[model samples]
Target: MKNFDIVTLTVNPSLDKSTSFRGLVPEQKIQCKNPRFDAGGGGINVSKAIARLGGESLCVFTSGGDTGKQLEALVQKEGIETHAIAVKNATRENLIALDLNTNSQYRFGFSGETLSEPEQQQILEAVSGLKTKYLVASGSLTQGMPPEFYQRIAAIAKASGIKFIADTSGEALQKTLETGVYLLKPNVGELAKLVGVEKIHADEADDAARTLIDKGQAEIVVVSLGPQGAVLVTKDITEFVPAPNVPKKSTVGAGDSMVGGMVWALSEGKPLQEVIRWGVACGSAATMNEGTQLFKADDARRLFEWLGRK
Candidate 1:
């Protein structure tokens, strides 16, 4: 178990299988290209992105059965240190198919197998035992896990004086906010929902994020605006980083890439402005690659330099 300053937790990990098809027609045998497999889950993908940036982090995830073994192998292939907890149920697999004709990506995600109470407790204990500076709890809560599961991790991070960065949605995210977090990366729509609004226009992003910061839900709130770029809001500072225009390929892991870039930059002691720029650069770079592949180191560096000129 190599020591790391950053630790990522992924309770519901997946093996992502991606492919491309010429056309999408109903019921006919459609020819598909060879599939590409990658280890996926919000936290795992984040670790992959960090690895791409020449950074290291300890990736903690649940593993079971053959699928879990494959997922572990894939993560290890990325050169990420991992701590996998054994479980009885098999891990889930997701499908990402690109329609070449329409340039549309169809993603089919499956629910992860339910974990027993003891299994869930084991995950909690593993997280509690970690000695790190930053603890990132990302991804969704599986069916068997309680909504407060992330909140429990947040409590542990707080008690240990570790900075907690959370990227999740719905009730799980909502509950985690109750315990407060060091940072939050939520898309515009998710930010709207957290602020009790149906939707938020681009101009309203900063204020909406401010609402959460004012509530002490999170110290920093990063609202991702997709193509328009991202905005970072803290108690006294707000900065927006526009996304660099680039040829789009697949958006499968863009958000996770953004989190990874920001976390890696933060670990390096970069300023908040540079942090958000790294996030947007990595996220934009990720869209240039197909399937679950994250950004290339050269690509991210190029984009970051380009952004610095702005």
Candidate 2:
């Protein structure tokens, strides 16, 4: 509801190239039967998910080399507004593991080069132009960036009086929370880390979620519980929303799409609980598709209605 729409930032973006193989055999030269590569990284995926839901998100990210050009085209081809910061190094690529018979897959990501001093400044400059009320910064920070890089972003958004929605893990996530993130989407593993709990059982994850809010790290904490669904904890309300049973080709990108849907719904000023409901639906729908692609708006909408009934 401002001069500009949503803006997303990806410090260390990537181009994900995945291959479909018949089977994985260790210690031998194996050729994938089929392979495909697409624009990747959390921010990129978020923007794409937003677009799929008929919303626009300005995607600002760093890229370099031929891969950068390719990524730029890929992002733009989806009709997303893009602001690319050129870097000296090339972009990073990830390998995807797929099992043909079982139709299961695993993905391994490689960390790209760290942004140089000037490159970092360019990002700060971009930060100055955001007019949107919501700014979502997701994914891991590239190495060589100060450990508190995400913290600095959170501070910037907070200082500007903007809402910051963070989705990340490890030190970057922890550091950003200290800067006062508006909301956080953490899976079971991440929530466990935030609360210093070793194993997060389904029954106790809600209590742990409350502890995160109590710690003042995040105003809203949503602990995603895969098939069992997600538990949303706010300062005054905590609800467990069960995801409808959907046929999942793969679980990749389901969480990211959930975050995107939540942000989009909130951007429209929908009610809090409804936003959580939409998020749960989107996450489950993304699982219904194979590969890293997010859920289609139709599927997401259908799932939302289906879940709303109960």
Which segments of candidate 2 are over 4 A away from where they belong?
1-3
Over 1-310, each residue of candidate 2 has an lDDT whose tens digit, in order, gives 2354677888888887776767677898877756566787888888888888888888889999999898899899989889899999998887776777678787888888978999998898888667778888877788888868888888888889888888888988888888778889998988888888788988888788888788887888888987899988887988889989888776777878898888888888888788889899888888887676678889999988888889
lDDT of 1 by residue, 137-242 (tens): 8898788689999999999999999999999999999999999999999999999999999999988999999999999999999999999999999999999999
Tell me how candidate 1 scores on lDDT: 0.94
Q: Indicate the worst ten consecutive residues by lDDT in candidate 2.
A: 1-10
Q: Once superposed on the true structure, which residue ranges of model 1 sit more than 4 Å away at CA? A: none
Native-structure RMSD, model 2: 1.8
Q: Find the 10 residues in a row with the least total lDDT in model 1.
A: 136-145
Best by lDDT: 1
| Model 2, residue pairs in steric clash | none
